[model samples]
Target: MSDIIRIQNLQKAYPGFALEGVTFSVPRGAVVGFIGENGAGKTTAIKCILGLVRPSGGGVEVFGKDAALLTAEERGRIGAVLGENCLPENLTAGQLDRVMRHIFPHWESETFASFLGRFSLPQGKKVADFSRGMHQKLALAVALSHGADVLVLDEPTAGLDPVARDEILELLYDFMQEERRSVLISSHIVTDLEKLCDYIAFIHNGKLLFFEEKDALYERYAVVHAPVEALQGLKDAVVAARRGEFGASALVRRDKLPAGTSAERAGIEEIMLYFIKGERI
Candidate 1:
């Protein structure tokens, strides 16, 4: 299957920060989770994909078209929920619906209404009165109601309670039922991404670290808790290690684990922490 979004050597520069040779692809029908710390260029990459910011170098293509040159129809097929709400704060959901209907040729009022009902969002309340979660739901409702083929969401569940976050995630899963729809979601919530994503892309300090199938990532790495002395023989296998008073925990290639060293499956969060904070072996 072709990629719904392809970013190649994408580069962007700010005063003290830069995205360097960042590259990844979101395959059609897959949920590709973008993972990183704050200010790690996740938002910047998303903006470049949506043509909201000009890249300093390299290219982004969405649906076979250059992102910088997307037509109106192409833009309509992509639904994005960035950090900020684009809807007017003074407008009620009812009013926003009318406005969106005029803006998107494929807008479905019934679907929008269903989403609002499902999310328990108030239609008569102005956006300014809505809580952060409510605002997110509204943005998602708008995105889904337009029959978008691809969804680009940055921190869509940020600030939401667990229950509300789960509800929104379920909606995204439902959206993928068609097998052609794709989603690129960036979140600090690794557990949510762990449950929902097929592939994972990790960024750190404005650099692309790894982009791989989530299952493959799990299969490739293991976390081993062993005494510092045990690590002496496994140096070649260790990616990074954190030494403490009691013991040392290291991220190692599963296949290379030395005899007598027990290794366990590492979750995404643990893996990220190892990559970001642990000392490289």
Candidate 2:
């Protein structure tokens, strides 16, 4: 598959937090999970990709064209739901749809209406009266209604219920079935991405910790829980670790694992924690 989104050497420097040397490619039809903690530069990198925030260095390409140089015509292919992505408190759900239809020439009112129907959103009810879940759904409806090939979402499921989160995940899966559609979603909800994404990239302290296929990430990383004394010898193998009085635990590459010892399969949560801990032998 060809690359649908390419972020090469992207850097956004700040007084305290900076995105340094960020690079990755999301191939068409691939769903990439942009995983990071709060203040980990996920939002900063996303803003640069959307051309909403200017970058200090590097380039962003969307659908084979530079995002920075993209004309409005070239940009319509991407749908974004960033931050709160809220509708005006005074605008009703139907009014929100109308506004979107005008803003996006390719807007699919029928499909958007169907999504509203599916989500059971009340028409003509202003956003001021809506619950947090309802507001989130409204933002999603706006993002998906335009028939965009690439969806760039940041923290879309931050405070959603399990059911609501599942619905969003299902929608993402359904969107990818079109074959030309792809998504770059950033979230701290690791399990959600583990369920929906084809690839995963981890960012921590404004630096890229790792980028790889989700399956490979699971395959190559291991969590070795051993006695405190045994942990010392294993430090040479740890990518990140924590040691104290009780005992020591570490995340190590599979190859560095001892021949006699077996490590537990690492989950996305464990991987994220280890990477952020920045423990190196």
Candidate 3:
């Protein structure tokens, strides 16, 4: 697959957490979810990619060209919606629209206006008067209006109601139908990603845990239940622990479970919970 964004041995240092040797490639036209717990370096990794924070080591390439060296013209192709609203609350939605339209050379005025109707954002109201969810939709509208090739979103679904979240995810799914557009979404909403992502990359404790295809995640990953005595000798399962009064259960790869063992298919939430609540990192 052609890579839209490639990170090679990426490293970033923090006072407490350090992103160490992280590497991943976001294939062109695919929606890849960057999953991790709070403070697990998801935003830090994204900031590095967006140049909001400089990496202490390694490289970032956008469209096969070094991101750090990209001119403003080259950088304009990438659009982002950060975790927080950076909009001027005093500005009316119309004013905000004008600002964004001016900033993005390819800005689609009709598309942006249509999204206002689609999102039901009031044009006359100041952003400060709008609820949290409204602002998020507005930010998304701005990102989509730019006619960007890549959408790099950070926690874009955090505040939306379930219906709105579904709508936004559906929009992403449709957006990629053009075969030249792509998205790199970092969200704690794993369930949403499970429904929308073509690829998944799990990051935790400032490190990468796993990177694989969505279908493989469901097919190869499994949750196994077994007795403590049985788990004691098990070497294939990374997750195994005694729980309650029943002994032990485990999260294992389907192919690696012991003889006679039958494990259930694991979903994204189950896989994430196994990583966080179980014995694994």
lDDT of 1 at 19: 98
lDDT of 2 by residue, 33-128 (tens): 999889999999999989998988989998888888887766778888886745688999888878877788788888888988999988889888
Q: For this target, which candidate reaches the highest lDDT against the unseen true structure? A: 1
Candidates ranked, most accurate by TM-score first: 1, 2, 3
lDDT values of the candidates?
Answer: 0.93, 0.86, 0.83
Lowest lDDT 10-residue stretch of candidate 1? 224-233
Give the alpha carbon lDDT tens digit for every residue of 1-281 in model 1: 89999999999999999999999999999999999999999999999999989999999999988998888778989998987666689999999999998998889999999989988888999999998888988999999998799999999999899988998999898999989999999999999999999999999999999999999999999998888777767899999999888889999998888666789999999999999999965
Clashing pairs in 3: none
lDDT of 3 at 209: 86
State the RMSD for candidate 3.
1.9
Clashes per candidate (backbone, < 3 Å): 0, 0, 0
Residue-wise C-alpha lDDT for candidate 3, range 119-235, written one tens digit per residue:
899999999998878888888888788777898999989978898788788778767888998899999889999888999989989888888889988878787677766665565
Query: Which is superior by lDDT, 1 or 3?
Result: 1
TM-score of each: 0.97, 0.95, 0.94
